[model samples]
Target: MESAIKWTSNETVLGFGKDAIAFLDTKLFSKKSPCDKKMYEILIIEPFYGGSHKVLIDMLYKALEDEYSDSKICMVTMTAKKWHWRARTSALYLSQVIPKQHAFRVMFSSSVLNLGDLIALRNDLADVKKIVYFHENQLVYPVREKKDRDFQYGYNEIVTSMVADTVVFNSEFNRETFLKSIKAFFKVQPDFRPKGLEGEIRQKTRVLYFPVMYDVGSHSKDYESTLHIVWPHRWEHDKAPEDFMKVLRKLSEAHCDFTVSMVGEQFTDVSKAFKEAETSLFPHIRHWGFLPSRREYLDLLSRAHVAVSTAKHEFFGVAMMEAAFNKCLPLCPKRLVYPEIYPNECLYNDSEDLFTRLAAFSRNVSAIKEVVADVKLDFSKYSAVNLLPHYVSLFK
Candidate 1:
């Protein structure tokens, strides 16, 4: 927990392992265990894509480093395709983003890695701690919903997470769903559910909400438009784009003076839902697709009156937080993790309720801000300051 490794590398040394020359505190360094001996080097199992996990990983790293600077972190990722983050010591096994044919060969194998600094257990690690984390996994995952690969990847996540010492979830919803799925899996293959495995899992399992990190960069833009609604989620089905399209069409028929911005990544194989929205509501859309500059996107959210999320499932809505941090009211459904993240009273269960709320917001936009203020979470509780201790306790 204390600063074990003296951080020596600057930004230039971080891109690749070229000069990953952080000083190792030999006096404190343990021979094998990467604990607080000399330097506490930790290995993080990165997500399939760059999104909320990236922010979580960054926050965890910073919070851990505030005291443990001598520590090292190695990220283990399946693909570097869309991942641009740099960790010199990371080990990439396979590109989960590539076609299934080519991916099978490169998918991560625990055999090839060096257990280095600390092997933060991940998918398919064959341990209870890691599997619990895998089971608790959530975050509007598009790849999981869009693809059908017999879940070789998910299987890997289950195995990897099971082996770790600490199994953590970003939200309680994610943790519970994972365990339920596992129990169901065991029902089919009863023998695989080891004798005392349930109790062990409960003991090791933890629900540690990830801290959000990333600047709400300076962006001052007063829109001429009266109603600025933002959908900052990815251009995918999880966001329920088809339903959002229907909302737009209904709102249009109502002749509401509103402008919508569709920000976030758009994959090559864009789904039917997004296509329908693009084709039908192209005129109403002001900005479409991902913007690399955080300022530009934050500016868009800041200026917007409402941040709408029509997600079918969200482990934790990072985009929702981005909007809320800047006073943009989140209008989301009372499903999965949304109610947990936002307010239970503010959630809408179906299209009728969502539309009803939207129509009301278009008339009294100030009500959106008022609603957000009323249910706004204590920022400190979700910050690195408070969250890190809870997270560290899991490791203990």
Candidate 2:
């Protein structure tokens, strides 16, 4: 059957009020009334639903269900693959997939989707309290070369923020960097750039840390044993695996008594650094590759002495925090989000600085182990117990 919905612009769609409802009744629902449709209190749309995106949604779903047992929530999601394609077309695809239900009070989504286009396509969602969460922004995301940065992806994010009733970021750094880069990001445009958009979007912006539940059991730290280091991050170029491998090679050259667990998620084309590390640092590797079980992964972190991150692009470091929660000391770069999340003692300015810190710790394993046992990293703010309420409140 031919549909009857039509709109001139996003403004026209969102400007819809009582008249739009009457129009829907007359046009699209000529045969059936709005009351005949299934009702839902909440609607969630996630196009790139994988990795941290999946983890966050799963946590939020469980939290919402636990809090409001009677609330009917509907979610539409796609697997996290071909991210660029998902970003470009997910909104249109999801618009058709989502069924027409009774008016939704709240709509939650990540920044991956083109929210403006989604709202334009689905008139029912126009007046809903739309919330877009930014796990990462493309504006400052490091590319091999500045020229390689795709303008459309970043522009889509800016437009998404404009349409959302509430715009949220996983960290303050994530929020600030995106807002700061808006002007610079638009400089590439030849003409007809927007004005006052940054300020307009800022009013609805919020910084909420990604909620993590660290249910770790206490483990005895052995001071006499060799120091175990874990590098738990994606084996991707953005994570800077090459830099990490170089540091491990340095430790081996110095004859440092340490073992490494190079474990994290890996794609089909694994980083070449891992293959190189296998031959050079074979004696030092205790565990390598992705551990399918969460229990096994957490167990490895619990036993390890240190967790290190050498990331060129990180909005928030979940792996580092997880390791820290499991009693492992986190060693991260001073720049990016490390300063915002970890203490100065845990951050290193350069590879030499990281090597120096690791060399000292490796030489005196007993001393470092004692420090880890005594001093606990306070991650209370990011805990699911504390932040879940904030997330739940957003729906209302």
On TM-score, the candidate that comes out on top is 2
Candidate 2 displacement at residue 204 in angstroms: 0.4
List per-prediction Cα lDDT, in the order shown: 0.53, 0.78
Q: After superposition, how far is residue 69 of candidate 2 from its true place, in Å?
A: 2.5
Q: What are the TM-scores, per candidate, against the unseen true structure?
A: 0.70, 0.87
Deviation (Å) of 86 in candidate 2: 1.7
Total clashing residue pairs per candidate? 28, 0
Task: Tell me which residue pairs clash in candidate 2.
Answer: none
Worst 10 residues of 1 by lDDT: 16-25
- Candidate 1 per-residue C-alpha lDDT over 247-335 given as tens digits, one digit per residue, 9 for 90 to 100: 88898889876778888666446666666677777767778777766657766776777788888767777778767777777778888
- Pairing residues by index, what is the TM-score of model 1? 0.70
**Model 1, runs deviating above 4 Å:** 1-9, 12-40, 47-49, 76-154, 188-197, 214-225, 271-276, 392-396
TM-score of model 2 relative to the true fold? 0.87
